[model samples]
Target: MSHTVTDDRQQQTHTPVALIGLAWTLVGVPLAYGLYNTVKAASALFSG
Candidate 1:
């Protein structure tokens, strides 16, 4: 019986910059906006 070994250390890959950007926009933007609004509301309530 003979066994052959293959080398897979030469895979070429491209960075998904657009996908990562879209993901950040979809999740991060809403989170940031929610936090901003919450802080504004809290500050207004306390300052009033």
Candidate 2:
């Protein structure tokens, strides 16, 4: 039988799902909030 082997450099390390989610949430929430408020203010400017 033949065997296959892989090297560490060929493999990628795994990051935890919760950590990824937390990082996105930290950045995404404020970004979305600021965009929302900016849109609301700009709408008022054009609607008048």
lDDT of every model, 2 decimals = 0.95, 0.95
Mind giving the per-residue lDDT tens digits that candidate 2 earns over 1-48?
A: 999886657667999999999999999999999999999999999996
Q: Candidate 2 deviates by what RMSD?
A: 5.5
Best by TM-score: 2
- Cα lDDT for residue 10, model 2? 61
Per-candidate alpha-carbon RMSD to the true structure: 3.7, 5.5
Q: In candidate 1, where is summed lDDT lowest over 10 consecutive residues?
A: 6-15
Candidate that would win on lDDT: 2
TM-score for all models, in order of appearance: 0.61, 0.74
Residue 38 shift from truth in candidate 1, angstroms: 0.4
lDDT of 2 at 29: 100
